[model samples]
Target: MKLLAGLTILMIVFVVFGIHTQQQILGLASDMQEMVPNISREINNENWDAARNDTARLLEQWNEIQDRWDLFIVHSEIEQVELYIARILSYLSSEDKAAALAELAALNTQLSHIYRKEMFNVQNIF
Candidate 1:
């Protein structure tokens, strides 16, 4: 029947969409991960200016990605990253290197959480 055919098409589309969404999320996380080393170096060297600039750039990239991600991901996960970025900025302003690094670690964890949750794993599906 036409109805059965239509339903099958819809299911295929859904699967494709889910796959694409997962890829996009993973890509965004990879981009962020790539910048981590430079940021870490800046932090370790106590180069506040460079660290601030790098973190700002990272935050900007995340903002751009988050706009598209909002359509696919839960807002809370997005908000957690946003909050972490803000906290990192604050710590940088105060020259709290320890706190800034801790916050960066938290941000990394959040990014990983987002990617893992969207993965097609048994834990997520069940």
Candidate 2:
């Protein structure tokens, strides 16, 4: 009976401590919420110039992806994605980033299917 009582006390202590720690972490982000609306209003005023700088950084990384597969007759769908990402990287908006990334994922799947068929075709021809 004493062991049970001790265990209950320990659980209560741990729960209290856990709640305290969660509160501390939430407090860190709480201030950001207050700051967000003001920044968003400024951003709407073409104050997102820094975002354009970020767009340039993303473009640098995008450019490193060589279009070596551009002429891959086996996967023209994937090539289309490489070209689309190259063009979409020119935009600074986050929406374009999300859209391009989503499209890229889908095209990769299509390319995988195309690659499997291509391999079979080569084997059968020989």
Candidate 3:
């Protein structure tokens, strides 16, 4: 029947949309994750100026993705990442390299968590 065919089409579209949404979210997380190593290198080299600049750039990227993700993801998890960024910024301002690097590591973990939570897996669905 035409009705049955139409319903199947609609269901297919819905499933595709859900998968696409998760891909976009994961893509954003990947972008953030990519920045980790460069920031870590800057910190290790004691290039405070460059590290600060990179962190600022990373924060900007985070803001750009944050709004898009809000619709699909948990707000509190997002907040935790924002908090980590703020803490990193604070440490940078005080020229505390060790503390800033620690915060950076924490930020990486938070980003990974967000990515894993959004991944299209059975565990995440429940």
Candidate 4:
């Protein structure tokens, strides 16, 4: 009876941790997604300075969250995001609108994929 109670408590704690992890991942992904469009618009308008600042801010935010993210997300996925951000920064520096936009799209897609993959759904269970 004591063993059974302990197991049940452990399961409850695991479930709570899983829910919190999912929420954090989703929230971070959503925040990053929201910034992408604004950066894209800045790029479209040829506002390089604003775009650069936004990209820097994005990188800063990523840096702040990445250690926590490393605990729950695959390292390769995290690395891919870092790579995309670096490429986007490079493109922005060169004033390459096409390339910058392309990278931003890729970054958005990656973030969407992360959240979708992390979602606690039937599809994910399989």
Task: Name the regions of candidate 4 deviating beyond 4 angstroms.
Answer: none
Ranked by lDDT, the better of candidates 3 and 4 is 4
- By summed lDDT, which 10 consecutive residues of candidate 3 come out lowest? 117-126
lDDT by residue (1-126, candidate 4, tens digit) is 999999999999999999999999999999999999999999999999999999999999999999999998999999999999999999999999999999999999999999999999999999
Q: What is the per-residue lDDT of model 2 for residues 55-78, given as tens digits with 9 covering 90 to 100? A: 344335434532433333335554
Please report the candidate that would top lDDT against the real structure.
Answer: 4
For each candidate in turn, the TM-score is 0.94, 0.34, 0.87, 0.97
Question: What are the runs in model 2 whose C-alpha is more than 4 Å off?
Answer: 50-126
What is candidate 1's lDDT per residue for 1-126, written digit by digit as tens?
A: 999999999999999998898888898897897787787778889999999999999999988888899998889989999999999889998889899999988988888888788889899979
lDDT of 4: 0.97
* Candidate 3 Cα errors over 4 Å, as ranges: 1-10
Q: Rank the candidates by TM-score, best first.
A: 4, 1, 3, 2
Task: Choose the strongest candidate by TM-score.
Answer: 4
Tell me the TM-score of model 1: 0.94
Pairs that collide, model 2: none
Question: lDDT of each model, Cα atoms only?
Answer: 0.89, 0.45, 0.89, 0.97
